[model samples]
Target chain A: MSRLELRHMRKAFGGLEVLADISLRVDAGEFVSILGPSGAGKSTLFQLLTGAEHGEGEMFFDGAPLDDHGRHFAFMPQRDALMPWRRILDNTTLGLEVQGLGRKAARTRVAPLFAEFGLAGFERHFPAQLSGGMRQRAALLRTVVQERDMLLLDEPFGALDALTRAAMQRWLEQMWRHHRWTALLITHDVREAVFLSDRIYVLSARPARVVREIQVPLPRPRDPTSAATRQAGVLEAEILDILLNLQPTKGHDHD
Target chain B: MASSSFNPRQLAGFLAQAAPAVISIGLVLVAWELYANHSGIKPTVLPAPSRVFEQAMLNRDALLDNAIPTIRATLIGFACSLSAAFALSMLVDFFQPLRRALFPVFIVSQTLPLVAIAPLVVLWFGFGLTPKIMLVALVTFFPMLVALVQGYEATEVEIGQMLRAMGAGRWRVFILARLPSALPYFFAGLRISITYAVVGAIFAEYAGAAKGLGIYMLNAKNNFRPDLVLAAVGVSAALTLVLFGLTVVLQRLAMPWERAAGRRAARKGPQA
Candidate 1:
């Protein structure tokens, strides 16, 4: 069964529609990326999928309709927004603590993952003590430690420098491979989308609609410097052309 | 290596910072002592530092009795103000409409000169600790409340959003994020309020009380013993300093991070 399905999803803010009739599906352990220009409603779609906002749509997780009472999905926001006052370990364990797990149990669960994510010795360090890349890694650890089957990441590496971002992408790919999560990521960087996804969904400008869904034929555990990465580049250029060529609707130039 | 161990330059820098205040106070005492000796100025008109020190020693028992009442009033009033202000701030934060409705009232109350109301408070509550305590609460509550509300509002939006994304509820966000962020603000307000607590207590005592430094000052003034009045004033100044120092200590305890940061900056010295 597919882990998540979004059907005919539509969203509007006042009179401005952000997403229009968007639909997608993710099978278990599949990785999908939504690529678009800045205001292409990529984030709006993530918000909708995570139930952060209400919209006109039908969303199913594990063949079950998304309801207010259900609590199976986790959303990771764009920014590395760890609480400044909390140590990295406490911040990572916050989700489990909220779910009524005691501190000791949550720490035990997070301890091994800290080493896996290269954050073992820094558990007692507060957010201000960590560098930006380390902070993002801690944020990612927090998201993954929730033990959810599906992860919705919105521009997780968008704020990092190019070199750090490249390193993080490879690290993320390894983590995903190890854990086999059904993941959906939103990004404006076409290269990032192509590098990390099994399939890329191209979104038009807001009131966004999915214009194309391109399946990436690149093999798993992909190297960014290889010929396969070059092929993905060609695919990214094609998606870029579609994004740039898209024109504003009549009298809707405010977008 | 020995020269570096006892660098004259570093010793000179430390002394340079301490020189002005120390010299100015020394000059003032010398001038006062000289004028009192040469001008035939009676000790009643202006107590020499020597006389005030002697008086302080002589009347230690009486001073202690009065100090106890003022200290009690200040502490009780400060505690009441902190609790009341924190609770009100939380209430205002939870309900925007209530904040909107009551915020103007809070501002107006603050604008009413506290000195004008201190007498009226004594009239209502009588010339006891009750009036003094009430006056201090009135003076301290508004600043603490304002600081707390602003602190709560100042929580970083991105941080709040991140916690929410983790499926953490409102109370969890507050306990983990909002409360810790507000500690610095709370301590800042407490510092301001601490100074006011002493002043407000003194003002209330001045308006009607039978004892306290304020009452002592009044009696010394009537008796034309300026030296005693100056001595009382010095005690009050000392009390304010003690209270302010207490706040700094509390700040250190509550936020060792700030103290560590301060030490780091000091060690780094001036950046060129």
Candidate 2:
């Protein structure tokens, strides 16, 4: 189990601020999302966490200060980032190999999960041979197979079509429920956040600030379109209202 | 590819792809054959295709004998050049200072005329296989080096970011991502250099050699037997095509996924 907390995190590139005094937390076995508009410095916060960039912050993991160079997170970029040359199975084992795990051993550990990841019989198929949804699934499998304590997913299914994206969202929730991995998803789609997360952090535009932390009291296996799930729709509208500036100014406002 | 069973459709598809090249070459050959017959330039000066064919048949043994040496030089020289290019590119890729220091020297090597350099090479090494192989290696090295460098640079930046996030080091990234991405470009460089390899070997022999197509052509030209010269020319061209075909086969064997990707694209159509 792993828990992550960030307090007053800030980042800037040269003179331009990207993340400004952002704060968030995720409990062990919880699924959380940072929902923001495109280019709202959401990825910058990830970069800070990954230690790929420097930022002013206090970050703690599992009740201890986060190590700047710890190998505790698995990242899935917006693109599948699948090597065009590697087959799906080999792609899934990439992280293991990078960490000095032998190829044969890594394959032994990863081959069984192909079925669970819905990639059965695709072990030898190149990424290009698979459909868009399958490729994204392969990418997700690659992320989780590392068995990292936390997952930092940046729009993993943003490239898929609407139907595929929605289907993937449901599939992701099923996987998260089964494995209960600590996951942090970065997305702009309010419905995706509402469907897949235990908590949602709505972020403002550039020089991003965490505007709201909303809890999801919905039951498991959520159906975002269900009439009974009126709360899901209400939360989506509220988040949209914040994003679109449909609400009047508040005390938290900064010029 | 080896696992696939026989398919006549494969042959037909191959023929379809070859059609444009065949048609263009056939049109040019027919025009040349007609012009050679009508123009009536002395056979000793510019032999007609028919006359050259007769000469080629008459001296087939000599042509084959000379061809062996040229082929040997081409093969050995190209192998050395490829190995050297691979090693140097790895060095350049791994070390920034070497890349900055050596890239300009690599480009300058290509600028030196092979004709000017070949004689000096033979004069230094003496009339032997050493000079021929060295000249060929020198001529074929730069294009491959450039291809590898460009291929390394062409890797997608996001891919590297993802790999770094995975805890992969510089060496692992090179082996897994950079090397695989460069295979297609390396094969392209091989095809380009191969044609030059044969020509370079012949030029090396022309400087001074006891055997090879170059020596054979020189003797034939001295005897005013342009037909034999042209026959040797034809043989060398044929040699280049054969070597080029070998590279294509090697490429297919090395990167089977490329063929698979093509098949997927074809099946999925343009929209995909």
lDDT per residue as tens, model 2, A1-255: 348999999999999999987988998899999998888999888888887888998988887888844377899999999998888889999999998899999999999999988889989988888888888999999999998889999999899999989889999998999999999999999889989999999898888998889998888877665664787888888888888782334655634
- By summed lDDT, the worst window of 10 consecutive residues in model 1 chain A runs over A246-255
lDDT string for model 1 (A1-255, tens) is 788888989999999998988888888889999888898788778767665678998888888888742266676888987876677899899878877899999999999988788787988866666666788889888888887777888899889888888888888888888888889999988888888889888888888888889998888788877778678888878888777677564664432
Model 2 lDDT tens row, B1-272: 46476688998999999999999988887887788788886777776788899989999999999999999999999999999999999999999799889988988888999889999999999998899999999999999988998888888776887888887889988998999889889999999999999999999999999999999999999999999999999999999999999999999889888888877877843221
Q: After superposition, how far is residue B246 of candidate 2 from its true place, in Å?
A: 1.0
lDDT (Cα, tens digit) per residue for candidate 1, span B165-205: 66777888887788888888999999989999998898889
lDDT of each: 0.83, 0.89
User: Candidate 1, which segments miss by more than 4 Å at Cα?
Assistant: A247-255, B1-54, B259-272
- TM-score versus the correct structure, for each prediction: 0.88, 0.93
